[model samples]
Target: MVGSLDWTAAGGAGDLLAPPVAAAVGAVADARAAEIDPGLADTAAFCEHYGVPMEASANCVVVAAKRGGETTYAACMVLATDRADVNGVVRKHLGARKVSFAPMDDATSRTGMEYGGITPVGLPAGWPILVDEAVAAAPEVVIGSGLRRSKLLVPGKALAALPGAQVIALAQR
Candidate 1:
């Protein structure tokens, strides 16, 4: 019911998701999935072509927070209309001296997800998932499926309740 795309139970779309995402879809009881043109995976193209409102889509960004000589990777979820406050709220919350978007290779390889389709779900254990308060307050939100060819739909509360997830004021707008 998100866009013009046909949605089906997430469990039946394993082929459209990365292994980790496919395995974790069961955690969200109302999770649904829809296939889309892989070439349109980027947020702007996907939303425009599929008729999904920008506000209804959430983007998951991978970040690297460094302190001393150690680096910690975390995922940040924010609505498409907002930007994650990586250098401000996120850095302080992560207790890192510096915070930036993770390198593309590191983000994709570590999470076992595609660069453009990373999602908070199925992330490696122990990694913090910072979800913007606006994202968690949405009635329903669309997010990545860990595969460029598909997207996942879930209730906002389920995302906030994911293991290691912490809802906070993480969006700049």
Candidate 2:
């Protein structure tokens, strides 16, 4: 709270993060979670309303693909300034016949998180978390808190280290 963003006043990261996500972030030395208004959940709106820079924001997307009759899911992290290379980088990295953004219902139901508030920290086991190289180099990045009511601020390197996470060139200008 002293050096960081008053984490205590922001409430315990435990309460703000999803159960699995809270455990993961709790282990990271530089991660901070803060409560936010749910109405301002989208990246642009939240950044503008909270006076945070767009460059400081990152988006986590859930991608789905089918390989040999089995459906697989992956979580991708990219800077707000760029889009995830779903059909190109992601599709190839995932090694699937087809790749696309997962349906909203599938994403929420499987991740146990809100539609627009999914984070790479607590994704289902076996699902790869693809992090854009640029995001992994950021000093600090704002990501979803698993719920629409809060946000997580973490060092980019920490995010790139999550289990099954792969730091790659996933962003497209």
By lDDT, the best candidate is 1
User: If scored against the real structure, what TM-score would every candidate get?
Assistant: 0.99, 0.92
Candidate lDDT values, in order: 0.95, 0.84
Candidate 1 weakest ten by summed lDDT? 22-31
Candidate 2: lDDT of 171?
Answer: 96
Clashes of each: 0, 0
RMSD to native for every prediction? Answer: 0.6, 2.6
Give one digit per residue, the lDDT tens place, for model 1 in 1-173: 88899999998889988999988888987999999999999999999999999999999999999999999999999999999999999999999999999999999999999989999989999999999999999999999999999999999999999999999999998
Residue 133 local lDDT, model 2: 95
